[model samples]
Target: MLKKVRVQIVTDRFEAKGSLYETPAGKLLPTPLQDMPAKEDIEHMEMTVEASYHDDGDRVCIRYKESELSGMEGSVTSVSFRKSEPALISMLRDGSVKTALVFEPAARHLCVYQTQIMPFEVCIYTRSVKNCIEENGTLEMDYTVELRGAQAEHTAFSMRVLPVFDKPISK
Candidate 1:
């Protein structure tokens, strides 16, 4: 039977690489494809996680402080992971992998200031869950999110989750 457990996440490293999209007309375009809240924004963030397992998959909801994000919106991120393989799993995020396509008239005279947002299909990968076990032991996993070209960029992060056990009080 699947059970619920409370764990704490120790964020080891979180960062996003900067990218520059060079146009055919030799122009550099920049976007919010970088990680927000700078590295020095937080000394260290440890968020409490509530995870539950179901028949088909498992779900985890994480809550953190808005101060950690600095200027970013929201403080909760829910992650869905499916357990199919014995040693590996995937983290799913739908409609997240998206890109902006420049049409004919738009790309003809496109400038950094005059950029338009368009809907285009971008590929999203279900990153494998590493360093995790199916048993009731210490679970450690690496979260990787790599999406480019005009959407929010979420870099990879590794966290260690240790189940907290409560001790009975003496009567």
Candidate 2:
């Protein structure tokens, strides 16, 4: 059986300015800072994501697109699941799951580290289960996802578990 889960994310934050400094040789240097180039009002943004899982339930495929005014608009991000229990266990034991965020449209130039299941981890968690059975014998599922991200060190963006599902009506 194949399942589809839909997720929506919204965020509002200000953009920071880039730091400028002069070196001892009178050369301008750029620092590695996560803040934006300038301070601005919090902009509202939304993203819609779809995740598909195989019948065996060991693998997952995800696709997401985000809309932002201050940053990259209409950006997309994707990831594939590798069947590695040991890797997952190791990540859990280490209290962090770090992975590069490769969403071409949004984070093309940025490297994102996602930590799945650890506290303050920057990652997304999803679960699906049979919710109800229709009178005509159609089964429905309830899907939930918890998403988290960090624009910079010590700055976190979080989306708590929000439930979205598809209900198959009987004929």
Candidate 3:
């Protein structure tokens, strides 16, 4: 069944060669900056938007739009996953900027990124993918991008698909 939903997406990104800080356990620490993607070695974004959610058999899908608040005003995004492949997910964005990205653990996908200037081919290497939508209403992915054959950035992306429950009106 398909129903209206509210989707919250949070993305944390870092340059492949960025960061001079690490945790005591030796893990890279996400940089903190006032503005997003501010060339300060790290970027972060969180957005909530209305969407449609559907689940049938073993497949789950969520579709949403990109508003001006997201800087992708006319774009639409669709994300889907299958229960059998819980470690993989597919995302497609159409409109101003169009692209289809497949996220699978330890795999690389070559995709075309369409822009107003021109279309460029980019390479995406997935480090990890966890789809817990059906179980917990969340999906997470980590991946790196290569632009023009050069490593660019790494992004940790997560989203929650929550049902919108309306309150009853008193007559």
Candidate 4:
């Protein structure tokens, strides 16, 4: 069955400035990273958006859009989760930036990140995945992103899905 749902997402991202010194565009950040103290940045985001949810008793799929609130406007995201000893989760995004990412505990996978200017390969190291979307309507994941062979960022994300219920008629 297909259902309309409200999906709430909270994501925390950490990045190291040293990794930004040289990107595909070249020399994006300050040079002489060794001379300067390693700088790190952390970002937190929370958003609630409408989504479509489908569960066929074996697998669950959720599709939503990246709105201005999430800072990735013009993007459509879909996540497929399968239940197992350790749940398997895969996410695909299409729009300005496109990528298909897989999350499996203690696994490393490479995927190409396509952007407006260019496309490059990135490595994803998944630390953990907790999928409770079927039991408690929640999902959690932790992973590190390596860009150009440099450990650039780590992200911890959690999401909760709530089915949309019809309101009662006012008396």
Q: Model 3, 41-69: lDDT tens per residue?
A: 56778999988887788888888999887
Evaluated with TM-score, which candidate comes out highest? 3
lDDT of 1 by residue, 22-133 (tens): 2234332232233445667423545555544333355332222222332222332333333543333333222322222121211222222111344333322222335354
Decreasing lDDT order of the candidates:
3, 4, 1, 2
Q: Please, what is the whole-model Cα lDDT of each candidate in the order they appear?
A: 0.35, 0.30, 0.75, 0.74
TM-score to true structure, per model: 0.38, 0.31, 0.79, 0.77
Whole-model lDDT, model 4? 0.74
What is the C-alpha lDDT profile of model 2 across 1-171, one tens digit per residue? 344556554444443232111112222222214333334444555555553322245633333443353143344443333343211111111113344432111111223344454434232211122211112211221111112332321122322222354332233
The residue-level lDDT of candidate 3 at 50 comes to: 85
Top of the candidates by lDDT = 3
Candidate 2 residue-wise lDDT at 135: 20
The residue-by-residue lDDT of candidate 4 on 49-94, one tens digit each, is: 8888877777778889999877679999999976554367889999
Q: What is the TM-score (0 to 1) of candidate 4?
A: 0.77
For candidate 2, the per-residue lDDT at 22 reads 13
Backbone clashes in each candidate structure, one number apiece? 0, 4, 0, 0
Which residues of candidate 4, in runs, are more than 4 Å off? Answer: 16-40, 84-86, 149-151, 165-171
Q: Give the worst 10-residue stretch by lDDT in candidate 3.
A: 18-27
Task: Point out the higher-scoring one by TM-score: 1 or 3.
Answer: 3
Of 1 and 2, the candidate ahead on TM-score is 1
